[model samples]
Target chain A: MTLILDYEAGNLASVKRACKEVGLDAEFCADGDQLRHAERVIFPGVGAAGSAMRSLAHRGLDEALREVILRGVPVLGICLGLQVSLDHSEENDTPTLGLIPGRVRRFNLDRTDLKVPHMGWNEVVPCRPHPVLAGIDPGDEFYFVHAYYTDPKVADCVLARTEYEHSFASAVGYNSYIGTQFHPEKSGRVGLRLLANFAAWDGQC
Target chain B: MLSKRVIACLDVRDGRLAKSIKFVDTKDIGDPVEKARAYYLDGLDELVFYDITASSDRRSIMLDVVESVASQVFIPLSVGGGIRSVSDATDLRLAGAEKINVNSAAVQRPALIDECAAAIGNQNVVLSMDVRRVEPTQALPSGYEIVINGGRQPMQMDALAWALDGERRGAGELVVNSIDADGTKEGYEIALTALISSSVRIPVIASGGAGKPEHLHQVLTEGKADAALVASMVHYGEYRVSDLKEYLQRQGLKMRMSW
Candidate 1:
């Protein structure tokens, strides 16, 4: 069973349904006990980083989430969940778990022509070989909705990236903790393939 | 980069597909699933089913119709009308809808955006505003008031300000429909749309007044909307999706046509 960390961050029903649609059972876990017993864990986030950071702090789920990912449990962070995995986010001016070495920065745009909160479906191209993205192709479209991205120094940490106003890291892999800026559940077939790969892969970190 | 979107808006009443001319003359447009699938194959990018029936004891969104369409189509589906609470949002999701659009109900309680955004991801919650250039009236900016209950009542709000506020309140995207131009096929209100688009941090969908392929191109290029939603033109077969996409490409707009 995959434990979905729930701190009122993002309980994407479709994400849960997508897992079930693929025949994997996931439980929304907001407590440490549930995380301790689960085989794997997922950090799903939607909404603003400021509000999300507040929600995580308010529920005290921030430390609980950090503990689980630090224990080397295969954990996946989606969107804002990925943002919170960093050291600091410009969004909420809040500090992240620092599980991954990076800072979340706003999209760098020279012109006001491009929209912020870069919403909608965009493509993802993986730069490194990893089990979760075993069969995915380059330039595969994935659903993305965010205003910030990570600037990590560790080259090995970058797994996938996509271009908008500029190219930025879309997915980062470190140890067993994986963070995806896109919602794999809503990303159609390619997304499901990535999730299925995650579900089947043995702890490799 | 995002491609131009062609939306098949299903107006349902009393649990069936309902379409009307100018919000009056009504008809059943066959099975919504078949209609939507035909559009999907025709290269439509998105689907929006407006619950025109919910307000009038005369209409209600057919959840059954939505479920049928959802099972057959994988594209993003947005359902609006009579969505008042988080339960309503969940009910639509359980019915297989990818997004729940709240209009009148959300303005009544801004926190409803939070309620829905918290339960379901904010991306799944769309806040659609029915805006019109009301006669320059009392203590308001530009006389652009938010219309609710199917444009039957006016709320004291500015369309431009609401766009930014909606995003701040946690709406994934804003669908700004120009009530004055809806179904007119005249063209989009570029000035109004651009004002709202530049004001907001999220992508804005331009709705109403799409008459020709040029209109789509104009709004997308000149108006600078991330996407344009066409309903009547596609529904009545005024123009084919193939023709529209080709026209957009010729005009130098980037769009992916998946067959």
Candidate 2:
């Protein structure tokens, strides 16, 4: 039973649908107890960091998620979910859950042609061997729509890297927690395969 | 490098999939969900669903179809047609649409773009414009005029100016649908596409005349479009999304190879 933590951010339905398509029994677990006891938790979000943190804090799921991660339960974060796991964010100058040793900063592209928000599909280059990227090809494209990105303090935590105006961390994994800067739910077959890999993972580092 | 996208646009009227010839002589093709599934399997980069009559009919969008198609297709789904307010955008988002496109409504009230962006995020708000070419007038110095209400009404706004305004108003993406070349299948209005695509930093999707794979390559490269929206070419079964994508890939355009 995989629980999709619901904290008022959008993309919950799409994430649940992706999990189901991957043959994982998933449910929206707004209740903290369900989130804590689920086999795996997918912390998905798509919004501002300040408001997302507020919603999680409002529902008291912030500490609940920390407890679940500390218990060696496999967890995956998507987009803003990846940003919120960092130490701090430039968006609203908000402090995040700090589950991953990193800070989220907006893209500072020097090129005039490069667009902000960084919307669309780009290649995901795997940096290390991890179960979440077991079947995904090194240059397989994933759907991305973000203005901010994660800069993990520990270089080894970087799972994959992608280039836009400049190369940035697109996926990160540490301990039992893994997060993707792109929306795997909307990335077609490659995305579904990644979700399945996460579902079958045994929470190994 | 970011790949060029091939999007399948379904113009649905009521509950059935409808295709138009130059925005008229409409004919029902097939089920939208089934077509969406076929496109999804064929590895189309994205999908766009427009409730064709919702705006002209003056009603809300068909959420049932949006929900049904969204459940089956797992790619980035963008829904448009009758999105008038922030609430309409919210409803579509709840129904599993990744992006909501505003056309006539945004022209009526430009603030609707900002409101929807605030309600959702800027990335989820798409501004779709129906544009027609005309002589360069004082009001529309770009020679392209903005048409609304399913291309039945013309506005004083210029296509290039409206696109820039939309981006400033917080629209994350823009769909420049050429009313003159829509459904003609002759080729994309490259001049119109290049004009708007170069003027905006946001991603621009060139909609309207997509007859062959070569047309897509032309727009994506020469026209500088981020994505190409296909209608009659794919809707009539003249070409599969895979065939078009493969042809584009061969032309040195970066495309996601599903198979």
RMSDs, each prediction? 4.3, 1.7
Encode model 2's per-residue lDDT on A1-205: one tens digit a residue: 7889898888699998888888988888777766777888899999999999998988878988999889889999999988999999999999999999989999998987778888888999998999989988877999999999999999999999999978899999989999999998999889989999998998996
How do the predictions measure up, each by TM-score? 0.80, 0.97
Residues B40-135, candidate 1, lDDT per residue (tens digit)? 667666788887764454322466777677655556778888888998888777776878899988888889998888888767888999898866
Real contacts retained, model 1:
0.20
Give iRMSD, candidate 2. 1.3
Q: Cα lDDT for residue B83, model 2?
A: 79
On the 0 to 100 scale, the lDDT of residue A96 in model 1 is 75
**Colliding pairs, model 2:** none
Clashing pairs in 1: B53-B59, B53-B60
Top-scoring candidate (lDDT): 2
For candidate 1, what is the DockQ? 0.23
Give interface RMSD, per candidate: 3.3, 1.3
